[model samples]
Target: MLRGFTPPYTPDGRSSLVPAPPWHYAGTVLSMACPTEPAAAARFLPQGFGRATGRIIAHVCEWQATTDGWELLDPVNAQYREFILLVEAERDGAAVNFCPMIWVDQDISLIRGWLQGWPKKLGQVWMTRSYGLDHPAAAPLRAGTRMGASLAVKDRRLAEAAVTLDGGEGQSLGFLAGPTYGLVGAPSIIGEPTAGALRLVLPGITGRVAGPMASGTAELRFFDAPRDELAALRPTGPAVAAIGNVAITVTGATDMGVVAG
Candidate 1:
C-alpha cells in the first residue's frame, strides 16, 4: 500500500497506444524542474515559498498532512526546513507513485550520462549510489517551508523527466505539458474531454500527459538523445488552454506515472 498521498486528475478521453515507460514504477529517476518565469517570481511571486507559494504550496500542505514522511527541519535558529515533493496517484490508474520535481540543463551532461546507461562520471557532477543507474532518481522542485528556504528557488521552471529522446523514425510525439503552472493546491491533473487524451494538472502551469506519438513509444526510446526528449515543453498559441489535457496513474512507492512523448 502507498504510505503517502494521492494527486488529482481530470480525464480526457484521448488515449494513446504507447504504454507507460519501464521506469515509471521501478527505480529512482534524476528529475530537474526550473521555474519558467524566474523574473515573475522575483517580481510578483510570494515573499516566501512552501505553503506561502500558493496552490502548489497548498498541495504540499495536504500531502504532508496525510502521508507519513519526513522533512528536513532546522533545530538551531529554529528556521529553514526542506522536504521532498510528495504526490499521490490512484492505486491503479496514475495515483500510485509520483515524483513531481525535476530540473536539469543541457550543459549538465552528467545527468544525461546517468540516465542513459549510468556512467562513472560525466563532468563536474558525479553519481552517488543512490543516483547512479537508478531508473527513477527523483529531483523534485525543492520546496522550502521556512522563510530562507523558499528564497533559493530562483530559476526557470524547466524540468527534465526520466525518459530518452532520440528515436529512429516510427514513433510519433504524443504528450501533455501543464495547467500552465503545475498541480494545484490539491494538485488537480486536468485536461481535454476526449478519447486518446489525458492530463494531470496544477495551478498556473503544471500538468501530466498521456498520448501517442509518431516519434515512437517513449518507453522504448527515452535514452537515445535524452537531452532532447526530456526538455520541458509546454504548448502555447491557440491550443494552450483548451486541448492540453492530462491524466496520471500511480504505480506504487517508485514512479508516479509515465508521460507519453
Candidate 2:
C-alpha cells in the first residue's frame, strides 16, 4: 500500500510533495475591493450558481505556514507569497465568493491549492512590508501609511494596487465575508470509457483570524497577459483597501457532489 497522502509515497512519507493537513498559515495581507462589470462577473460562475453580485476582492499576501511538525524541521517550505481574486456570486440564494484565479510563488503551495480546488498558478508576487522601528523607512502602521503590491507571471505584470492607510477601524468588508467556493476536478480522456471525471466543492478553511485592521482608499489595476484572462475581471470603479494580519487553518473538505451538465 502507498504510505503517504500523495505520490512518491515512501516508508517514511518524507518524499511526498505535500504533508497531510491540518495546514496552518499566518500572514499580512493587503486587500482591495471594487465592483466589476456585472456581466463579466457572471461569465466566471459555474453552471447552476445564481446571479453575479458585481464585486471582486483582490489580495496580495506574505505568508508563513506549517503542517503539523513541518515548522521546526522543514522551515523552508513555510514561507511564500500569494495573489488571489475572489469574485462575488450567489449560490442557492445566498452570497459566496468564487475564486477564479490565484497565484503563488511556491511549487508546494501550487499543489496544495490544486488539492483544495483553487486554480492556483505559479507567479511572482510583491508587496510592501512593515517593521516596528522608529526610522522613516519602516513603513509603520499609522495614519498616512502607504502600501503597494503587485503580481506578475513570466516578467509580465498582471495586477497592481496601492493604498493609503487612514488609521480608522476596518470596514465590515461584507462583500468579502461570504464563504469562498472553488471548482476542483479533472477531465476524462477522450477514449477512456471507464475513466471517471471528478469534481467537488473545496474544503472550508477553519480557525480564521483577521487581526486589527487599518482601512484605506485604494487604486487597483489589471493588465492583459498573452495567455491569461485576468483582465476580464478588472474593476471599473475606485477600490476600498485594507491592511491586516491573518491566520487560517485547513482541516478536511466535505464532498459537495459533482456539477451537472
Candidate 3:
C-alpha cells in the first residue's frame, strides 16, 4: 500500500544472502567493543543538545523502482545521493561489526554499492582479522530481540503510512509513517529508521554497540531475503518508529527553485 513499495524483509538465520552486507548474519549480536570516543560524533554535529546533526548516512538499498514496476530513476537517484552524503560524515569505529540482513523493499544492487563504497574496518576479533566475511570474534548472542513478518499493504494510503509507536504521535499530521513507506516488514538486528516509518533501528543492535555513542540502524527491509516485491509485514513486538529516516534540513537547495509560477 505504500506509495511505491509493498512490504519488507530481513535475512534468514542461515546467512544465505551474504558476502556483501553485514558480511555475515549476526543475530542478537552480543559482544561489546566500545569505540575510542563515545562522543566523537559530537564534533560532526556540534551544537547544543537541541541542535540536530545534519550528518547524512550512506546505506545500500535494493528493489524495484516503481508502482507499475516501471522504473523510478529520479527517486532512486535522490536516494543514492543522500547515501553518498552520509558517507561524508566520517564515522570510524574502532570496531564496527558486519551484521548483514535482508529487507524486501530496496534494490539489491544499490545495497551492495552502499556497503562497497562506505568506510569499513578489519580488526582482530579473537585472534584473526575480521575482513571479507571472516571476522574471528564469535560471541554467542547474549541477548537479542527479533520479529518475523508476512503481511502486505492492500491500501495505497496504508502502505506508506507511519504511525508513532509512542512519543512521535499527534505531532505528525496524519498516520503516514514516512514520505514513501508505511513502516512494515522484516525485523532488523539494527534499528535505524528508513523505508518510511516501517524502516528502523533494532534495539538489540544498539544495546550491544560499544562505539562513539553515535546511532544508526540496519534498514532491514532493504536487505531482507528473497529480494522481491509483494513482501508482507512479519511483525516484531513493540518498539520505536524510525523517527529520523530521511533527515531533510534544506538550507541551500532553496536557490535551485526560483519563481516559475
TM-score of 1: 0.17
Error of 3 at 226 (Å): 9.4
**Candidate 2: where is the Cα deviation over 4 Å?**
172-176, 188-200
Candidate 3 TM-score over all chains jointly: 0.20
The local distance difference test score of model 3 is 0.21
**Which digits, one per residue and each the tens of the lDDT, describe model 1 over residues 1-261?**
212111122243223211122211111122212222223222222122122111111010001100111111321211111212222222222222222432222222222212221121211111111211324443211221100011112232221122222222222111122211121122234574333322233311122343222121111001123332212222111110011112332321222122231
Residue 101 of model 1: what lDDT?
34
lDDT by residue (1-261, candidate 2, tens digit) is: 558877789998778888888988889877788999999988887767667889988888898889875564766788899998988877778878878889999988898888887889999999999886767888877888888899999989999987888888766353236677777776666687443544656566888888787888888999999988999998899998877788889886666777642
Total backbone collisions, model 2: 0
How does each model score on lDDT?
A: 0.20, 0.82, 0.21
- What are the models' TM-scores? 0.17, 0.91, 0.20
Which model, 1 or 2, shows the larger TM-score?
2
**Which segments of candidate 3 are over 4 A away from where they belong?**
1-73, 79-97, 104-163, 168-237, 245-261
Worst 10 residues of 3 by lDDT: 25-34
